[model samples]
Target: MIRIVIVDDEVFVRAGFSALLSLADDIEVVGQAGDGAEALSVVRQTVPDVVLMDVNMAPRNGLEATLQIVKLPEAPRVLIMTSASPDNTAWQAFATGAHGFMHKAATPAQIIGAIRMVAVGGTATTPEVMKRLIDENNLRNPRHVAQARSRIDLLSGRHRDIILLVGRGYPNARIARELSMSENTVKSYVSRALEKLGVDNRTQAALLVRDSGLLDETLANESRVL
Candidate 1:
C-alpha cells in the first residue's frame, strides 16, 4: 500500500482528500494535519510514503516545512498542493526537492495519480507549472543565477538552443518542428543537454536555463557586437 499524509490548513481539505484517497485500494491515508508545524509531527509518527502539503499555513508555511521535511533521513516524497498562483510556488517546490506541485483544484484522479507517481520516485508537474518554474527562476538570487548560467555554459551551442526551448516548456515534437530537426535528433540533444547541466529531469534543466538568464545575456552580447 502507498501510505500518505495530507497536510493543509483547512480541515475540510484534509478530510476531503483523505476520504477521496481512501477509495483507492492501493492508497492509505495514514495521517492528516491542519498546519505545517503539525504536519512535521504527523509525518514523524507515520513515516508515510508521500506527503501532500499545502503551500500556505500559519506559524510555519509549507515551503519552510518542506525545507525541513526533505532533510529527514529516509524522507517521504513531498507533493505540494497549492491554492495560490503556481508561478511563484512551483519553483520553490522543486528547488526545495519536493517531488511535485498540483493546484488544489486538480481533480481527484490527478491528485491520486500524482501521489502514486511520486511514491515511486517519479515527478509529477503540469506543463503550466513547468513554465511557471522557469519564469520565476528569474526572481531568484544573483548567486543562484550565476551558478545556473555557469552550468549551462558547459553545453554546445545546439544543446543550449534545445535547453532554452525546454526552459519554455516545449515538448520534444514541438521543439523538433520549430528547430527543423527530427524528433529523434531532438531527443539525443535533450539527453546530452540534461547530462551537461547535471539535472535529473527536464524541469530542473529548464529552471537552470531560466536562472542562468541565458536569453537575456545572449541578447545583450549580440546587441553589443552590432
Candidate 2:
C-alpha cells in the first residue's frame, strides 16, 4: 500500500483528503498535520510514501516545509496543493523539490492519482504552470546548451529524436508520419520516454524536454537535436 500524510491548515481540508484517500485500497492515510511544523513531525514518525501539502499555511510556508521534508533520510514525496491563480506561487514550489503540484479545485480522483504517481517516483505539473516555467526559462537563459546536454544524456539517439518531436507539440499520428513509424510505435516511444523521465504524463514529459533546453537546440539546428 502507498502510505500517505495529508497536511493543510484547514480542518475540513485535511479531513476531506484523509477520508478520500482512506477509501482507496492501494492507499493509506498514515497521518495528518495542520501546519508545517506538525507536518515535519508526522512525516518523520510515519515516513509515509507520499505527502499531500497545502501551499498556504501559517508559520513555515509549504515551500520551506517541502525543502525540509525532502531532505529527510527516507523522505515522502510531496505534492503541493494550491488555489488557481497567478499568485499561487507554483514555480517556487517546484524548484524547492515538490514532486507534483495540483489545483485545490481538482477532483478527488485527480488528487489521488497525483499522490499515487508521486509515490511511484513520478513528477507532475499542470499544463499552464509548465508553460509558464518554460517561458520563464527561455527568457532568463536564451542559451540552453547545458540543459540540452543533460536531456540528451537521458535517452538513446532515436528516443531523443522522438522526444524532441513530441515537445514540438506534434500529435502521435503526425509524429508517426514524420518519423515513418506506426502510430502504435509512436505511442510506445512516448510512453517509454515518460517512464524514463519519471513523469506521470506526456504533457509533463514534453515540458521537461522543453525546459531542459533540448527543444531550443532542435530549433537552432533545424533538426531533431535531442
Candidate 3:
C-alpha cells in the first residue's frame, strides 16, 4: 500500500483529502496536518511514502516545508497540492525538490495518480502548470530561440519534427494524425527524442527545446516553406 500524509492549513481540506485517500484501496492516510510545523512533526514520526503538501500555510509555507522534508534522512517524495497558479508558485515547488504538482481542484483520481506517480519516483506536472512554464520561459528568454535552433540542428529531421510538435503541446494522438503515423509510432518517436535530448520526459524535452530557442526557428522554417 502507498502511505500518504496530507498537509493543508484548513481543517476541512486536510480532512477531505484524508477521507478521499483512505477510500483508495492502495492508499493509506498515515497522518494529516494543518500547518507546516505540524506537518514536519508528523512526517518525522510517520515517514510516509508521499506527502500532499499545500503551498500557503501559516508560520511556514509549503515551499519551506518541502525543502525541510527533502532534507530528512528518509525523506518521502513530495507532491505539492495547492490552489496557487503554476506561474507564481509551481517552479518554486519544483526547485524545492517536489516530485509533482497537483491543483486542489483536481479530481480524486488525479490526486491519487499524482501520489502514486511520485511514490514510485516519477514526476507529474499538470498540463496547466506545464503551459505556464513554457509561457514564462518564452517571455523571459529571448536567447532561447537561438538555443532551440542549435538543439534542433543536432537531431535527425524526424526527431526535430517530433520535438516541434511536443513544444506546441500536441498530444501523441494529434502528433500521430498530423504526421500520418500510428500512436505507438508517435510514442516511440517521443521516447527517442527524449533520449537524444538527454531528458527524462516530454515536459523536460519541451522545456529544453523552448529554452534553446528552437521554437521560433521551427515556426519560421515552416512559415517559409508555406
Better of 1 and 2 by TM-score: 2
**Candidate 2 lDDT, tens digit per residue, 50-71?**
8889888889778889989987
Better of 2 and 3 by lDDT: 3
- Compare the candidates by lDDT and give the number of the best one: 1
Specify the poorest-scoring 10-residue window by lDDT in model 3: 199-208
Segments in model 2 whose C-alpha atoms lie over 4 Å from true places? 84-88, 143-211, 215-226
Backbone clash tally (model 1): 0
TM-score, per-candidate, Cα-based: 0.65, 0.67, 0.65
Scored against the true structure, residue 92 in model 2 reaches a CA lDDT of: 70
Per-candidate clashes, comma-separated: 0, 0, 7
Give the alpha carbon lDDT tens digit for every residue of 108-146 in model 3. Answer: 888888887677555677778877876776675555566
- Cα-lDDT of candidate 3: 0.80
List lDDT for all candidates, in order. 0.82, 0.77, 0.80
